[model samples]
Structures are given as C-alpha cells and as structure tokens.
Target chain A: MITFSKQQLKIPKLQRPVYLVTAGQSKFDRAFPDKRTEELCIDSFTMAAQLLEISPAELKTYIHSCYYGHFADHFGDQLLGESVIHDRLGLDPLGNIGVKTGGATGGSTIWEGMKAVASGYSDCVLVMGWERMDEVPTDEGNFLISCAADKDWESPLGHIYTGYYAVMAQRYWQIFGKSEDSFRRTLAEISVKHHGYARFNPYAQAPMDITVDDVLNSPVVAYPLRALDCCLMSVGAACTILCDEDTAVKLTKNSKNKPLRLWTSAGTHTLRPADRMDMDIPLLPNETADQYKDLGERFPGGDRYPGFTGFLAARVAAHYAYGMAGITDPTEDLDVVELHDAFTISDVQTYEDIGIRPYGEGRTYVESGDCYHTNPNTGQPGKLPSNISGGLIGCMHSVGATGIMQTFEIASHIWNRWEEFHGDENIWNKFNRQKPKDWTNLQVVGAKRGMAISHAGVGSHVTSTILMDPDHLINKDA
Target chain B: MSMFGQVFVKNNQYKLKGDFHHMTPNMPIRNADDEWKLLGVTNPRAMTYMHSYGGEAVFFESLSQGKLMASRCDNSDCNITGTIYMPFRIHCPDCLAKNSVFDLTDIAKKSATIHTFMECQRSGAFNLLDKPIKFINIEFDGVATILMSYLVVGTPKFGMKVVPIFKTTGPTYTILDLAWVEEGTKEEQLPEGFSF
Candidate 1:
C-alpha cells in the first residue's frame, strides 16, 4: 500500500501572513466574440480597483509582480498570452509568469502569488486568470480537453474527457449511492440548486429556473451523468489582489472592503486515475481511521481508498490548508464554501473529499438541504451554505478564471456585499441580463470564514484557498 | 493529392516521408445581425504529430503479436519489490529503477475483471470508437494498478470477467490496438481487426 513520508506530511508554514484585499470578475458567458481577452481582463482588473475605491493605475502601482493563469494556449492559439495582458494592463515592467494546472490553473496561480507575498518576495501581487474556450468548436474542445489526460492511453478512448470522469461517477453511484432513484434525484437537486442560485448573480451565466426533472431529462453525455449534470463551458476573466499587512491596510483603508487573511495550499495525485494504487485514506483532522475501517463492507466496492470514488488531492489539499490555517473542523469552523462542481456527481464527491461530509454520506448534504442557501426542508438558513454564486455547474467553468471567481464569490458574502453586488441594477444592465423579480439576497449574516476548492482532472491537482476575517482567526498563533 | 505522413527511426533520428501538414485558407465569419459585418476568421489547418512511446514502446508493439507485456520492479532491496504494472511503467515509481518487462498475456486471459466501467454516448473530434463506448477499467490478479480499456464483445458491468483482444490484423501501434472482451467470446465475435 502507498504511504506518505514524514516530510511529505509536514504542515507548511508561511513566513508572514497574506491578505486578499479585493477581488473582481468580468461577465461570464459561453463566448465573448465581441471583445478581446485583454479587454475582459482589464474589465475585471478595473472592478478590483473600483472595489478598493481607486483607479487601475493607482492599483497597478502597488502590484510588485503578476501571476497569470490561462489554461489552454491552444484554445486561444496564442502563447505568452500573459505578457500581452500585462502590457495591455500597462504593467509592462512588472515580472509576470503563467500558471496552468488544467482546471485548477486559477487556484494554482493564487497559490503562487500567495507564496510571493508570504515569503516577503513581493509586498503586493496581482493574480489574474482567464480562459478562451470559445475559440474551438464543442467537439474539438472536448478533444483538446482530453489532451490533459494521458494521450497514449486514456485520450484515445472516445477522445472525450467526460468519459474519464464518468467512471468515477459510476463507481460512486453503485457503491455509495446504491443506484437508488432517490440518490439520482439528489444529484439532480444539486443542478437545480446551483442554477437557481445563478439567477440572482448578474455575473453568472446559465441562470435557469430548471427543475430536478429537467436535469434528469437532459441528454446523457455518459450514463448517470446528463447534459445538465455538467458545468458550463464558459469564457471569462477573474482577478484577485493579494498583499502583505501594511499594503493591504493602505489599499482598503478608504473602501468598504476588509483585508481577509488568505491561505492557499495544493496537493496532487496521479494524473491518470489508472495509475492510482491502493492506500490508506489520508485522514482529515475531523476524520478518524475507526470511521472507515469497514468501508469496504459498508459500501461493498468502496474498499479501495480513492479508487474511482474520491479526490485524494482535494482531501490532502484541505488537510494542509486546515493545518496551516488552524481550522480543526470545516463544517463547524467555516461559514461557506465554493467547491469545484465540474459535474453534479463530482460536486457531491468534493463534499466528502473536503470534509464537508464523511465518505459515502455526501448525498445527505444535498438531500438534507444543508448545501442550499435556504434549506428547502426547514425554510431556515443552511448550516453552512455552499455555492451561493452558483458554482461552476451554474456559473461558468472558464478553466483559469473559475477558482478566482469562486474566491471572489465567497469574499463577497464575508464582506457583507453580496446583496450590493448581486442586487445592483446598473450591474445587471451592464451585463444585459434582466434582474429576476424573485431575486433574494443569499448573504450569510455572520460569515467570518469561507473557502474555495479548485480542482483538476480526476483529482490530479487540487488547491484549497481559505479566507477569513482577521479578527475571526481560529488559531491566534496562526 | 499529398500522401499520409509516415516516419521511421534510423540511427536515433527520424526518417520522415510524405506530407506532414495541410494548409487551408481562412474564411471570414460575419455577424448576420449587423448587416453581415466582418466579425472574425476561421483558422483551418491540420498537422500530424510524431510521438515516441520511449521505454514503454515494447508494450504497444507486443499488442500486434497478441502478447500483453507488463513491467515489474524486481529490486530485491526495494521496500516494494516484485510489484507488477499493467500499463507498463518504464521505471518503478518508488525505487526509480528501470522495470523488467513481464509478459502478462496468459494471466490476463485467465483472470481479469472489470473494477469500474462507463458507457459514453458522445465522442470528440477524430474519435475512432463507436458511440456508447463501453469503457472499462480492469483489475488483474497480480497487478498493482488497474488498466483502462474498451469492451468490444459485450456490455460492461462491475466484476464481469474479461479477456484481452489485440489488433493483430492491422495494428495501429497505439493503445487502440488493445481491447477487452467478455470471457468465452469466440474468435468470430471479435471486431474485424482484433483477435484473442
């Protein structure tokens, strides 16, 4: 069985604290043919500056370095796209580098920028990410995405990336879900919830009043994974400004924004799931070995740790993030989360992976309504609502911008600006979307802490980014 | 008409022949709503890629000979010794030693079962597999990792016994040359190019 070395298990320590002063995003849609990527990026950067009550030029002065994440150079048919964007943003002299980890490119970019500030290399940094999936047709896009898998082995099998992920959904459905119709409906409910939440967010795409049956009846891409069970293939840009304590205080002094403490940690597994070997489950602080000793017996085919049922990368990333941030239990400590809901089934899979719920019990998080903004069953606020910005399933999965979008979403709730952002008439008109008459504010009243999980292929790479109000630190020593 | 691209290795260098790329002129994309305004242009081009299998070349070549080659870490001093890899690891992941090739044709024929399987209804550009591809990840009796392959003869289900089939007739020299079929599948039942 595979095991971890002591050095590998050691918790990471940052030299100094990093803070997320402000964040922003451009309108997310299926395509942006009318605008260039640099223009979209400038729109997002302008909003980030606007949130700090400053102009883009004023904000550019504080940025010591830049980290740009654009997942597929082939999609844009342009390499060194970062330098072009940096030049367009008028930050030509600043050192900038590109980051790509498939779907986790945005989070990996943040992980790099966080280290830059935490290590005293840069007092202030700009983390920007965008994707241009519209350049290719749907079929060719699927082929390009499949290139992320092992080309010699897995990619040739239909050349569809969804097939690689569907195997895991099938395993989880049979073993944990027991192939129950109720479990299937619970999975569809996630689509309904995410799409429903999207109606209130002006920046969100695919805002539909779709039902669980609508999701169930959608075309099937793979068995047990329907068209609606998937995330939107989107094009967009998102950015976040991270800085040291002094820079953060100076940047957000005049604005309504609060500099939230930030911690970004990542973990990885075999790129191809076929290479996964049997190993003991890497326990989270909230999990114990005793709880999973009889996992195989309980779920029949659930014996193999992360065989086709779990994201070990997310589990390990959350482990390191929680350790570094001194969060003992996620469900009790954090107020909200934005999981990488690439698919509805993967959404539930992440609930288990990131310790929102235990293994084999992720469905309950949805079935019991704890994953909703307003628990439908009780009509009360959810224990810890997730994906209030509709997440990738309903918002946009623009690859490089997705993780940053999720972080921007969670930060809005913690800053008590969710309503102000989502309810503004000018914002809806700017994006040319009609405000839903039934739009309800989804702000968690006392959100002091939140997190976003950015993931790549079959758990190959996963980064957990945690943000908390400075005064609400779980561990004072941290 | 240009011939298909072909390459062969000689003296550790590639001997290339025929056309490797085809160029197509770009077409103007117009916006109908704005009185057919010029919006963008399509980039139409195609090129063949030459990829090397490197140390794992034997595994793909053996498929045409109806042989399933695996690799084993035979380092006696290594903590994890004699561990077999079906996907044919060039080097032992733990010890970093070059793995020894082990023929696994007989073992696969005797005992191979589907660990997890998926039926995909769609494919991407240039996909050769038929619709509703019965993708299966098979678990061998002694292999450390699972092998991903498509089922040819029968519908896939968890724990269903399967045996290997190879494209011995006209091998592609790629992973597509290796496939699986349900146990007791007859020779005639195999796909035209594949055989047990």
Candidate 2:
C-alpha cells in the first residue's frame, strides 16, 4: 500500500495547466533514405501544425521557442545539431534548445517545453525529436549506440547495449526464482501481446501475429533476449505543441475534444550503481512545504538507502509522478500507460516499476493476461491497457523521437483521434501479412487519464509525465 | 496519406556494406569524454571489434602486474565510507568533490563475490570466443564499485567467491587482460605449485 500521509501528500496547485493541443509523427519503419532528418522534422512539425489549422507562417509567428531531441549526432548527416536543422525549416530565429539524454531525449525535450510554457517563458513551445539510424550500418550503429553507456568503464569491456539489458533480465529472473522455460515464455508472451497491438497501430514499425513458440524459436541476440524481443531500429520523427490552457481553448474552439492537463513532468539520473540502489522517490514538482517537511521526517537525508540499484530511478520517477497526480493506485487509477519497452523483458519489468504489480511479480502479471485489453482471467476489460500503441517493442525505436511519440499516443487517446491516423490497408498488408484481430474498435473506450514514461537505460535516466482529460481535472461537478 | 506513408514505396533503402568496413585497427578518435583517449580495435580486414580503455590506463597496467587496484577519495569529507571505486572515478559522484591531483589507488583484495552474471548465447564486439561470453559482475569486498569482467573458467553462482586471474602473456592492458576464476579453484591450484 502507498504510505504517504494525506498531510504529507501535497502537490503545488498550478495557476493554469499546460495543454497538449495536438501532436503528429512520421510513419515508423525501417530506413527512409530518401528523406533527410530535416525533412522528417518538417513532416512532424507541419503535420502537427496542420492538425490545428495553423499555417507554417502562423506556426512560426506563434511558437516562441523550440526544443529538438536527437541521439548520436554521428548517426545522421547533420553536423552541428538538430536545432540548426530546425532553423533550416524556415521558422523564426527564436533560439533552439537541443536535448540529448539517450533514449529519454524526446521525453526530456517535451518536459523542457512543457516547463517553458507553464512558466510563461513562452506562450507556445514546439518540441520535435527525430533520428536517422539507417545512414550507418548495423556494426557502426551498434558502436554509436554503445557510446550512450559509461564509455571509460562499461563500453570498453565489450558491453553491448543489448547484452547489458539481457544481463538485467537474467538477474530479474534469478531474483524471482522463475524457471528458465517459464521465464522465456513470459518474455515471449509480452512480445506476442505487443505485436498483436502493433498490428493496429498506424505508426508501428513491426506488426505481426507471432506466437510464444515463434518468439522462443527466434534467434537469441543476447542470451535470453531474442531478436523478436528487442525493439526494431528504425528511422522516424515525432512532434508536439504545448500551450497554456487559455491558448489551447482559443486554438481548439472548433474541435469537439478538450485539451489534456499536463499534470507533471520530471526526470532523474545517476551514473553510479552504488548510489542508485535505493528506490526512493525523486524530487517531484508541486510538493508543498509541509510535504517536504514530512518527507524529511520519513526519509531523512544521509540515512537514505544507498544499496538500491540504478533501475530504481524509473520506479521512483513513476511513483513520484503518480503521487503528484493524486493517484494512489496506478493499476486502478490509470486508464492507459505508455512506457519505454526497449526489450520485452523491459516491458514486463516496467509494469512492476510503474506500480501496476508489486516487484518480481511482473512475470505473473503477464501470464495472468492482465496486461491485455481483454483479460483472459475474468473475461472483463483490462484494468490498465499499457503500451496500447505497441510501445517501443512494436513501434519503431528511433532513439531520439520515441518519447514524444509515446506522449502523442496518450494525447491521441484522450482526444479520441485514433481513426484519423490509422495506417493505410495496403501498407499494413505489405509489412504485416495477417490482419489484426480487430482495428475497427481498437481504442481504449473512455480513457480520461493516462501516463507516458520514458527511460535512457537500466534506470540511469528517466522521465515520467501524466496527462489527464481537462474535463476530469477542470470540471469538478461532472 | 500520412506524411511518412506517402513516401513508403520510393523512400525505403537498405545498404549492404557497413560504414565500419573501412575502419583500420588503430584509427584513433578521442572518446566523447575528452578525459579519455580511444583507439579503434576493428581490423581493416577482420570484421571483429573491441575498445581500448585509454583514460584508465593505470588500472590495466596494475592488472598486468597481478595487482587489483581501485581509486579511493583522499578527502575524508567527500565520502562517507572512504570506499574505493573499481573503475576509478575522477571525482566523487556523490559529493562532486574534485579528486586531488594524485588520486589514491588502493590495492583491491584478491577475493570478491559474484554479484551478478549472464551467460550469453552469442558474443558481441570482441569476436566469438571459444565459449559463450560469461559476463560476470564481481563485487570486491569493501569496494563501493562493482567490476564487470568475464569468467574464463568456472560457472558463476549468485554469491560464489571468485579471484582475479591476469593474462600472463600478450596482455592487451585492457579489461581483456583480466578474468575471474572460482575461489575454490584458486585455492586448489595455489597449494599444488608452492611448497611450504
């Protein structure tokens, strides 16, 4: 059970909640060699701007600042930075802030943009993230991605990124005492579930009907992690526009949907594994002075648990986010969740990290069919339909653009805008032969509140943000 | 059509040859961290690759001489435990206190516990070894940092004791110079060679 007292549970009241007006993204797939990073950025930016009926000129005039996220500058042809690429998009010279936090770069960029608008630093902010992984070959790509790890120590020891996570999966299994066969099957089941969901996601990179047998039979890239269990390396871009509630109302007056209340966006990081042992709550926004005092009383400084693993960063980030959002029970409270699923094992682990299940029970949660939209256990709707957009597992893993894409999925569900972006039938058939079980009714029916969490590595850097239907937070009587 | 969907047919392209196909074995590039010097390991002809740990050259040098070393903070105020780091830290991560001009290198005890490990079905970076990569995380007693190395000879258990085994010949002065043997075997071999 959550332990914070009501007196200790204080969140700063926002004068005005930032609203995610609209979001858009380029189709996620293998290489898009003909299109440069700048063109992809433009596609996402213009597509988002178009959704709100704003012309390019109007967007430039209205957007006060921009944040661009990208990983591995060497991956693409662009030299200086992605922000310079944004300048090439013909937007006004409102200085560009580039964000690079490995995989969490996109999520961190959005959080930065949200803060800028919420603080009145900018009336409207544009956040775009993109990556072009196809420009380089797999080996070079592997080397470039490996650069994200602790280079002096970790990378030099032949620590491939996939191997690092596969080791964690192995440890996680050992801690829970899961048999090898059961552990492998559970991880495979997660992939099957994600592939099933991705079959319906218009932006997903790999959508196929695979079975546990297939995932088990797939070639193992890193011991326990099969090729199918890992996210596909793809090229894509995603963008979002964040504005004050007043600006959102004026801009979306004609649209039937209400904007979402950007509840909280926060990040945490620690490189040393020793210092990262404790699963303590991160420094959250909107905490009251009294709550701070209460926190000091409970988790006194210098007395904090230091043996906690760095993986706790993601759990703590999600915990503090849920606490600030007044959500005591994530499984019951959150309607949908979009989290970083770099590996199938990472997916199940995140279910526990986000508090949907207690630690070490993520495997049981998956086998229980609780993670699906239709729970096979009780024949009832799933409690929390996570990674409904297929997540990074089924969706493409474009290092920099993934976070914003997750945020966009949550915003789309809240706005009930899935139909507008569904993939064309021909393209879907071309990539994935078998049709999804059902795409006609694929949306999470009435999702009022949702969350999107992203991470850079084995809990080294994490960003968790919650977005709720403005009607739920604003209209108290309803 | 969506922005990306419209370009579906004509845009997708795949290249057969990798960008690293031409990289020489000694292609030098300063690591992203300016503090470190990096030399490329992939041979121009050989598709195999590995990285040289240039910044912590002293650590590997110590390994070559059969010494396990770790960096300890000289400033007592900087660390609560005054513990050592296996992959020595330039500064105190917790206190952010800059290490002295001369960092303290403490001799790590020859013994450690297997903190964690993974037996990979495939090898990465360093080409296929005779056996699957037995990546082990070794926790030296009292050292604050965990050392990641390969277990060359024995199966690893969660808390099994292990000892370092340095390469006697052709030492690369990288982590490749070091491996771990089960503590049970270390004692088994020690009594056989030395006479009282």
Against the true structure, whose TM-score is highest?
A: 1
lDDT of 1 by residue, A1-478 (tens): 9998989989999999999999999999999878899989999999999999999899999999999999999999999999999999999798999999999999999999999999999999999999999999999999999899999989999998888888988999999999999999999999999999999999999899998899999988988789998898899999999999999999999999999999999999999898899999999999999999998898998989888999899999999999999998899999999999999989999999999899999999988888877889999989889999999988999999999999998899899999998999999999999999998999988999999999998889999999999999998777
Off by over 4 Å in 1: none
lDDT of 2 by residue, B1-196 (tens): 1121111122544223333333345444345555656533222343323344444666777666766656666677653436466766556665666443322222333557776677766444444234467777766655665667777668877777776776545565666667777765644453221110
Task: Score each candidate by Cα lDDT.
Answer: 0.93, 0.68
TM-score on alpha carbons, each prediction? 0.99, 0.81
Lowest-sum lDDT 10-residue window in model 2 chain B: B1-10
Q: Count of backbone clashes for each model? A: 0, 6
